[model samples]
Target: MLAELIRRDVDDIVDEWEQFARSSIPAAEDLSPEDLRDHARLLLLAVAADLETVQGEAEQHEKSRGELPDNSPQITATAHEHAQHRFEQRFTLDQMLSEVRALRASVLRRWVEQNDRYDPDAVAELIRYGEAMDQALTESVAFFGAKVDQSRGLLLGVLGHDIRTPLGAVRMSAQLLERTKGLDERQSKAVQRILSSSDSMRSMVDELLDFTQTSLGMRLPISRVPSDLGSVCAEVLAELEALHPERDISLACEGDLSGQWDAGRVGQMLSNLVSNAIQHGNELPVTVTARAGAGDVSIAVHNKGRPVRPQSLATLFEPLAQAKDMGGDRHSGSSGLGLGLYIARQIAVAHGGSLEVVSSEQDGTTFTARLRR
Candidate 1:
């Protein structure tokens, strides 16, 4: 899936480059050799860089999967070397100028042949096509720029929002500590609880900021070391146990469980799932299970809660789309950004995996994350 996604993205890049190149060539009968050489050199350089980045990422993935053939890297390197060699050996600035002049001459001949009896309607249609193409290219550039700006704005906004809650708690706790100088044991314990909750809120805010950054297209600098899925699960369960003592949480690992993954990301994904289960799974016992196969590992979190309606399931992973309130009183406390599941799914996809949900009135809801080994 990751490879396919990367390939599609690369194809889109190539298509955009081709369209830009086609549109950039001037429609004059005469051209300078220097200009042609400059254009071709720049275009070739951009294409080479893009191809190199895509191939490098693919090689890294193949290396992670232990499936990199011995000749693959050599072939990639050779292709790049050949492109560089051609860029240097095949055409000098003067040669490019000559080529461009020849191309201009050819275009002029074709234009004269087609210009003798051109209908007014055909001329107008061609003008309209050019205008539309220009408009489309302008809009595409602006749209991408706006998306990048919006992503940055969202990252800053979320960071500020995440920080405010914990800072407020810390300030409130400090005031209470100063005022309750001669308080009873219960009052002191209450103050301590406030301090503890403040600390937890701070940690959660950090995680939220990190998760937001990752979701907003920040690449994970992952190291390909052998990792134990069971150990990651156990650590996540232990952390969740501390956070939610009122609920019984269990981790079940079946068979030989080992894989290569970013342990921190895996833990974060699990933490998000378990946290969601606690928040929306009611007060029932939540169980997390993990199973590893030849080339994949699956982790599932099950909670005994009301089933989700079929209509709500479709948009569950969409931003700001929450599961409908199963009952009037249920999920009353889940009033936030509604980004947990969305972030979890992003993390899963980033890991070349996916998160899926299954629910019914008979059994309860289960969210499963499957990562490739």
Candidate 2:
């Protein structure tokens, strides 16, 4: 049978597999032979054993769908282990997959050479072997992708933290320069630019840190104290007005705006919404409204401009979703890594609230955050 043949020639197949993997992948160049051959023998034996299992028509269908019982634990465990080791070795995902591909080719070539007679059993065995390889590849790829995401989150966390110290120093220096006496007009303008640029960089760093926290499956931390929604909206609007002097931004508040909430996070959410409106609102006036419902508080930022595309509405708040400048008077300084809305939504969610948007050509676009008190 094919299983016995695999068991007998596994070593020979692995030798060819190792050679091909080493030659094809640059990262494998520095790895020792033992590392290169890691888990190969076990993977091959697991596949051979899986081929020998008695799978009925139903099980075969489930296997094809990747929903069948894991007949061999070794395949799954070895795939994860191998992928983890390769990731630590600095091998790229493609490079690691190339090794798997080489092993598949080596084994298939040897099997084909031995089985010149094309019969039904031979065809079925070949199909099963391909399925096994595919299963292993899927496991390894998933594990590798998870590792990559974790590393990226860690790097972003470190970068965001490390950059803040220098950014703070620059901002402090600019503030000191602004207070200096007898400054010329050009010098004053330059200092203002420095402070503005520093604020922008600080905003981006905060967004990156928030993105890292959310992507790592952690909710945004909030400290709820006795805070007024009206005060929060006013403070955020004042800051935004200073940053965007040319934009006409107004705030309207009514009905008990006092609540127990994180005022700072709410301000952050409002700032993101207002900035997005100003950038995409086609140089139009933006309005902020806060209303107190029976048990909830709703804050909406409205702007008149081109409506967001219907398709994009679903993913508008997803991190890194391309905020395409869709032929409008988008602010020149509005470019970002597309994490503003995502972080805003996360903040709202953390406060046991939700953020939503409604856009239409005639009615304009409005983003609303409803927080439960």
Give me the candidate number with maximum lDDT. 2
Worst 10 residues of 1 by lDDT: 128-137
Query: In candidate 1, residue 372 scores what lDDT?
Result: 86
Worst 10 residues of 2 by lDDT: 326-335
Model 2 lDDT at residue 274: 92
Model 1, residue pairs in steric clash:
33-97
Q: Name model 2 segments beyond 4 Å from true.
A: 69-71, 325-335
Best by TM-score: 2
How high is the CA lDDT of each candidate model? 0.60, 0.88
Clashing pairs in 2: none
TM-scores of the candidates in the order shown: 0.53, 0.96
